[model samples]
Structures are given as C-alpha cells and as structure tokens.
Target: MLQAIRDTHRYSPGELRTALRFLAPLGLLIGIFVLLPVLGTLAGSLYLDTTFLERRFAWFDNYCGLLTDHTFLQSAWFTLTFAAVSVPLELALGLALALLMNSQVRPLGLLRACVLIPWAIPGAISARTWELIYNYNYGLANALLGGLGIVGEPVNWLGTGAGAFAALVLTDVWRTTPFVAIILLTGLQAIPVELYQQAQVDQAGALGRLRRITLPLLRPIIIVALLFRTIDAVRVFDIIYILTRGGPGGSTTSLSLYAYRNFLGGDFGYGSAASALLFVVALGLSLVYIKMARKLKIKMR
Candidate 1:
C-alpha cells in the first residue's frame, strides 16, 4: 500500500518544476481575479451593510430577503424567460443559416462574411439600431408594416410589457443568431462529405440524410453552441441597458440590472448576494450542459 501510494504521488524534481512553470500564470490569474473576488463576494453576501462601512454578519438573512424581494424575483423570471425564448430561436435560425451557407453556392466566402456583419457589430450599437427601427413613428418596422397594410397604425413596439419583452427578444436574436451560425457552420464544415455521399448512394433523401447523418454527428458542436449562447443570454446587459434600460414599467429588468441597481443604491451586501446567485445559476446551467454532452457520448476537444 505504501509503495502504491508513493508511486501514485511521486514526481521527479524536473517534472515538478516543469508542471509548476506551466501552471504559474494561470494560477496567478485565478487567484487574483476569479478566486479572490468570488471569496470576497460570498463573504460579503453574509453581512448586512451599506457599502460595507458598518457591516454585521447576517448569515442567511440576505438570501431569505432575496427570496421575498419582488424586484429580484421578477428580474430572475425575466432573465430565465429571455434566455429560454431567445436561445432556442437563435439556435434554430443559426442552424438554418448554417445550412444555407454550407450549401455549394456561388461566392460562398462572400456570403459567409456578409452573414457575420450583425455579429461583428458591437452589442450597444446593434441595440441602438434596433431601438430606432422599433421606434413608434417613422421607424422602418412600422413603415414596413403600414406599407404592407398589416397594421392600420404604428404599433408601439417597446411601449408595453409584452411589446418590450418581444422587442428585447427580437434584438437579442438578431444580434446573436449569427454567432450561433458561425459556430454551427464550423461544425457543419467539419462533418465528412463522404458520409453524405454514402447516404446518397443508399438512396437516402435530404431530410433523412440530415436527420441520420448531419445532426447526430453535429451533436457535440450543437451542445457547445447552445451552452455558449445560453450563458451569454443569461448575463445579457449591454443590449438591454441600451435599448430599454429596464423601462416601460420595469418589465424587462434582468438579474444583472437588478444587482446593478442594488449596488448603486448602496446595498453592497444584497448586491453581492444577487451577483453570487447569478454566478450559481450560470454555473448550474453549464454543469447541466456538460452532463448532457457526456450522456450523449459527445467527445469535446
């Protein structure tokens, strides 16, 4: 038993030195930025204070208060609903775009570049652009609807709860679907053309080939793309900030926005608790994705 333990744990001095050298930079970064801040936030969340100047350890009081906080609850629900609605739409649109781009069309390179334009634009800029387009009067969206006689008057796209939510979702989908497409496009490109050739030789239809060959092989990439998009969607701030500012009756305030408001209001302890909750939610979703990927036997590189 002693020999086995020694064999398992032992490392030569040179190997130890090499390992430390490789790990040093990453360890330093994690310690300074990620580890210390998380520890501080967790510690801070347990206290009751205004700006940490007169803090008192409150144990789980802050968490308990959070559960009953209407604004926080609403923001949490909004964040979840936003992610739920937008991520799937983005994925579907992205997959469609990837399929279109993956086709053997003329000027495919140019088409791919054009498709990246929306994703290349900064989030704030895109949000502002969408805001203009969704404006009540003289906006392109309203003008188009009027031109097509779809509505008798301009619809207030961001003036009501449902409209604001829909507008936010639309803006997010427009800005993010391209990113999903680019990731999935790389995945689609990685698929061996020979598989399709074999399927064709077996007299498989296009839909059959896609269902049996393309999707199964692309499962890992799809999972990865969804994971990335879901994380981004959950923490979405800049776009919402620029477009709505959680306005039109606080209908679209997200968890991040709620935390920001609390922090700005000098409730550091509660703000930290909110931020910690956000971290936990993001971490939990990521773990779920990892488990699903593993269950699907998808090898990630």
Candidate 2:
C-alpha cells in the first residue's frame, strides 16, 4: 500500500505540472488578449454613454437603436454585396490561376512566386498604392486609358459612387487573389500525377480530366479556400476605409467600417451592437463552411 501510494504521488505531481505547462500560456493569452477585450467591449456596450465621464447602465437601448439605423442598414447591404460579388470571383480566378500555374508552363516556380507578391503585401499599403494609381489627374490608370484612347478625359475614378465601389473591388481582388491562388495551388499540387497519367492513357482530354478527376479531388480544398476568403471579405475594412471611407456618398461603406466609425464617433453601444450582429453573420458562415466540409468528407468516403 505504501509503494502504491508513493507511485500515485509521484505521477500526480508530474501530470499536474505537465497540464499546467500546457495550459498556462493559453490561459494568459485568453485572459489578457481575448477574454479581457471581449468583456470590456460587452461592458462598454451596456453603458448609457461611454463619453459620459461617468458610468451608467443603458440596457438594450443601444441595440434597439442600431436595428433602426439607416446608416447601419446601408453599410450592411454594401458589405454583403461586396462579399457576394468578390468572394465568388476570387475563388474562380484563384482556381484558374492555380490550374494555370500547375500546368507544364515555363518557369512555373517563378510564376508562383510572382503571383504571391501581391497577397504578401500589407492590405492598407496596397490600398494606398492603388489610391495613387486611381488618382484622376496624375495617375497611371488615367494615363493607361489615355494611351489606349479609351477615354477623352481622365476618369475621376474615386469621385463617383460607382467608381469608388469599382476601385475597392479591384484593389481587394488584386491584393487577395494571390492568397486564393496559393491555397488552390496546394490543392492542385496534392493531385496525383498518376491520375493524369492514367487519364491520358484512357484518351481523356484536358477538360474531361479536370472535370472528372481534378475537381472531385479538389472540392474540399476549394471549399476551404472559399471559406477563408469569404470570411476575410465579409469582415473587410482597411482597403475600403482607406480608399473611400465609405464615401462618394457612403457607396462603399462596409459593416466593419461602420462599426469602427460608431465606436470612434462616441456611439460605443451602437457600434458594439453592430459588431455583435457581424459576429453572428461570421459565425453563420463558419457553420455553413463546416457543414459543407463535413458533407464533402462524407461524399469522399
């Protein structure tokens, strides 16, 4: 009994130490970064006014007002439209780029590296660069159009609602497509060469092989890539904010930017409500993605 007791005591401390070592850093991260901020935000959102220099509870008034706010509605719609348009286009373009890169093209390694450069750059920096290019008077975009005789005057690219929206889409696409390409490239590279070899032996054309073999095997990866891009696009703020500030008459405002402005503009509770709503949307997308992933897994099996 003493020997068994000693053995138990020996293992108990070791196990406890091991568990503590694993959990300590995680606990610190959660407490300091995640938990604290979330609690602060929630607490702030419940207050009557953050700017009051005094504390008072507001209950659900902020949330109730947010539901009726026209600006929030417009921002939500604009953000949704941006995601709906951009995510599908990015997926298609990225997959196409991945396939092209995967082909027996010359200097494929260099090509892949070149393609990733845009995605590797900081998004705000990319936005700023595009903003310069988009400048009406002295921009390269106008110069190119002029060179091509496409227009008689320098297009005020960011001066109109449609123009600003288009610019945001273009900049985002340019910056993020490379990431999509990289993700799809991983999927493409995972495809067995033997499958293609056998398909060729069976006299399958490129399109037939891709349709029958490549896509079936790539569905999961494609879904994953789409999910990642869609999530990012849904919460997109920096590019649009920097380029348009939801301007040209709030034409390009997104939910994230809207929430940020509310919070910064001293409507903390309302902003928090908007943020919570956005969280719901993001969470819904995540659930859908997970369901799709599971369905793909079942189909694969």
The TM-score leader among the candidates is: 1
**Global lDDT scores for all candidate models:** 0.90, 0.84
Residue 160, model 2, lDDT:
86
Reference-based lDDT, residue 94, model 1: 96
Off by over 4 Å in 1: 1-20, 298-301
Backbone clashes per model, in order? 0, 0
Question: For every model shown, what is its TM-score relative to the native structure?
Answer: 0.90, 0.87
Candidate 2 structure, TM-score to reference: 0.87
